[model samples]
Target: MPINLLYSPECLEYREAGHPDSPERVATIADFLGQKKAGRFLLPGKCKEEDLFLVHSEEMVERVRENSLPYDPSTPNIRGIYDYALLSCGAAEEACRLAVGGETSFSLLRPPGHHAGSKRAGGFCYFNSMAVAVKKIPGEKRIAILDIDGHHGNGTEEIFREKEGIIYVSVHQFPAFPGTGSVSFANCYNFPVYPGSSSSTYMKKFMNALSVIAGFSPDLLGISAGFDTHRTDPLLDLPLKDSDYYLMGREISSLNLDTFIVLEGGYNVKTVGNACYCFIKGIGKEKHGQETGKRI
Candidate 1:
């Protein structure tokens, strides 16, 4: 089967002036993924309140609806932010749904969700969309989340750190923003890289992650794909290239997973789109481990 991708217009409402994260990232990716050659792509449906409640606490959901400040000190407040957040969460859920139903899918959602924990909403995120989808997937299955963002995926770790079935792995710049991936949580894997990391560094960490995940044998793989690791990205000091994402995508696809990729973090708009294009090409043109049943 071919890979599927999900996107929505609501993602555009998330505006951060003078910041790297912007709607241009979504527009570029969507336009590329929606191209005629890409077999499966979708404009995701709106996520319901119940779906949002799955990962976040009721209090947190209500708080976001009632009151949400700027997505952190970095970005300014935008109008109708709450509605956009709901759609982003919904789009992530749609991605998971397609992946679980035997199609690989990606959610190009922004105001990314990995940073938002069960109760808190900061770090340019208002909802824990990845967590919500992971928790709600059908069947008793183990899910592995590979977060390759420049900064730590603090919210995801906090939500699933104590759990056993979920394998949460992250490779990020240490002593950066929201530093929390260094300490090992139960079934949690982490790689805190030095300031300057390159393709070799990323590949090494990915291989290590593969070794760690081989034992876990996840039913589905959820990738928090971020471009903030790109060398040009001002967020961190990781020196990554566009081709790096192709290798990363091919490696993850080689795992033969029912993959659900969610847009996590990426600042520079130009590289983000190019990186995404390469990733999709890798997922489509590259094939490995042809045998396919339900994963895990």
Candidate 2:
């Protein structure tokens, strides 16, 4: 049960200099993974066009393929962006496949895609990679998407709101970007926290959400793992220390469901590296059938 760190090389091909969400994020993760070297490292291939079309409309899907231009003024669309996005989507799918097969894997992809939707791309995302991965898991039943990004998972929510096969849970800062997750709903577990909220508050809400996760008995679980909530993050005001991330990952691993973790937002380099290392520690502990020690 070695921990497999899954990623795609195409991530490096799409770059946006000075952007909060940049290729450097994946580079940082790759460097850390180099240190861990826990198990077989899996790299993703290009995603099938049909797979991309499953969630995104034909127009939206082709808009990214027209070779219109590389790197949109607001977003990065490089020559390989079409392929890079496909690879990220494939990475997520492979991560989910490994989890469903009872293998512990982490998707360290780029162009963090939680913000992408059926017909739009923003927040550095070109395709809803998490949603795409979830769709790959053949199921005609309810599925739960537990998003922990600093920003609300607006795209994920928009795609799954009226759909019955998905439950989108978001715990983000209040008055945050793309604010659509605060109001409580049967299908959406939107818990908006304020800046400076401590681990105690974060954990309470997370524990409550886990109960919902249990109720859903999700055939598969997807995490939009974003570490920007760390206090030191340039964009976020929350103060989540490094160890809190390990506790979060460990708790999620305890659910015993197929868990797919697609890398999302995290600006500050220091915390992203540390938090990813911490998460890997938790996932590695789970793979070894060992206790995650404590909530360090």
Candidate 3:
């Protein structure tokens, strides 16, 4: 089956001036994927307010909807941000649905989530899209969320920690933004990499993370796909090359599990596009039973 990309042009309608989480992050990737003819693009609808409640508090939802919260430097309260956030969350839900239906899918929309928790929003996130999407899955199916963002998904960890039938694994930079995920606890397994780590070192940790997911034997896998780990990304210090992303994608695909990816971060607009394309290309290869050489 062709990979399905869940996206909507409306996700590009909001942005804070000079913010690293600019609209171009997803825009560039979308354009690149279109040019590459990588996959089929599916427009996503906005999620309901109740969907936000699945992982966030009613107060938090109301705060964003009413713009009643105080100004947060990281998560701004821009005009109509509530709707934009809903659209992004909706894309995640759509991607999850596609994956559950035996389709390979990616949600290429933002303001990147994974930092917002049950009661608060931060780190350029107003809603924890992955967390919300995972919670929406029906039944007692086991699920694993692999957060590959450079910064730890503190919010996602908090939401799913100790929760039944779900495990959260994050491989991110230590002593970085949010300063969490240094230790593993309960259902949350964290692998914190130091700044300026070599690509091989990062890949080693990534492989270790994949091992954790493999052990969990989840019925579904959700990837918080963040590209800010790239060497050129100004937001983080990890040194992952473009090819490293392809290797990561290929490794994830090798697991042969139903998977869905949600965009998290990648600030360098110039290279983020190519990075996404390479990752998706790697993901597409394995489905055809193609041997892409030895895994990292």
Candidate 4:
């Protein structure tokens, strides 16, 4: 099965001049993936305003809707941002829906979530797209969220901190923006790696973290896929190359569980598409010593 890629042209409407989370990130990746004929391309439908309430407060939802001014420091309240945020969440919701049906899907979303919480938007995010989607999926199955963004998914962590049947794992650059996730939790495990870390170093840490996920024996896997860990990203410092993403994808695929990925953070426009393409291809590859199921 081809990877179900959920995307929408409306996502490009949430543009802010000269911002790292510019609309071009999704536009560029969507075009690149299209040219590659990478997967089953799709346009996401709209999500209800009530869906937004699943992961965000009504006050926060109204704030993004009525106030066109920037609520977060770096996240611009660009024109049409409210509609675009809902659209992005819809994309993620669609991906999760596909995953629930034993198919793998990826949501090419933005203003990248993981930074936005229940009450406010931060780090270029307005809505917790994955959170909203995860909540909508009908299941009591154990879910594991592996966030490999360069920065800790502070908002995602906070939103689901006390929730049961879910384990949140994050590997991020230490002392970075938002500055949380230093300590581990009962359900959340965080690995704060040092800056300027090599790819091999990251791989070791990631592998170790994977053991934890494996032990959790989750019925489903959700990836907060962030390519900003690449060394060239303008936002943070991590020396991961494109090959690293492929290796990470391959490793994740070894688990052989139904999985869905949501776009998180990656600012290096030049390499972001390559990184995503590599990871998708890696996850789509066959895994040995295990009977394979349809992944994408």
For all predictions, the C-alpha RMSD in Å is 2.9, 3.0, 2.2, 2.3
Runs with alpha carbons beyond 4 Å of true place in candidate 3:
290-296
The predicted structure with the larger TM-score, 1 or 3, is 3
List, residue by residue over 1-296, the lDDT tens digit for candidate 3.
67999988788888789888888888999999999999999999998999898999998999999988677888878899899899899999999988999898999988778999999999999999998889889888999999999999999999988999999999999979999999999999999999988999999999999999999999999999999999999989999888998898889998999999999999999999999998998898787673345443
lDDT of 2 by residue, 11-84 (tens): 77756567787777778877876777745688777678899888898888887887553445656555667878
Estimated TM-score for each candidate: 0.91, 0.91, 0.97, 0.95
After TM-score superposition, what is the CA distance of residue 209 in candidate 4 from its true location, in Å?
1.8
Q: What shift in Å separates residue 115 of candidate 3 from its native position after superposition?
A: 0.3
lDDT of 4 by residue, 109-164 (tens): 78788999899899888899889888998858889999998899999998899799
Q: After superposition, how far is residue 196 of candidate 1 from its true place, in Å?
A: 1.0
Clashing pairs in 1: none
Instruction: Name the TM-score of candidate 3.
Output: 0.97
lDDT of 3 at 225: 94
Local accuracy by lDDT, each model: 0.78, 0.78, 0.91, 0.86
Clash count list over all predictions: 0, 1, 0, 1
* Tens digit of per-residue lDDT, candidate 1, span 152-204: 89999888887867889988888788877776657788988878766697679
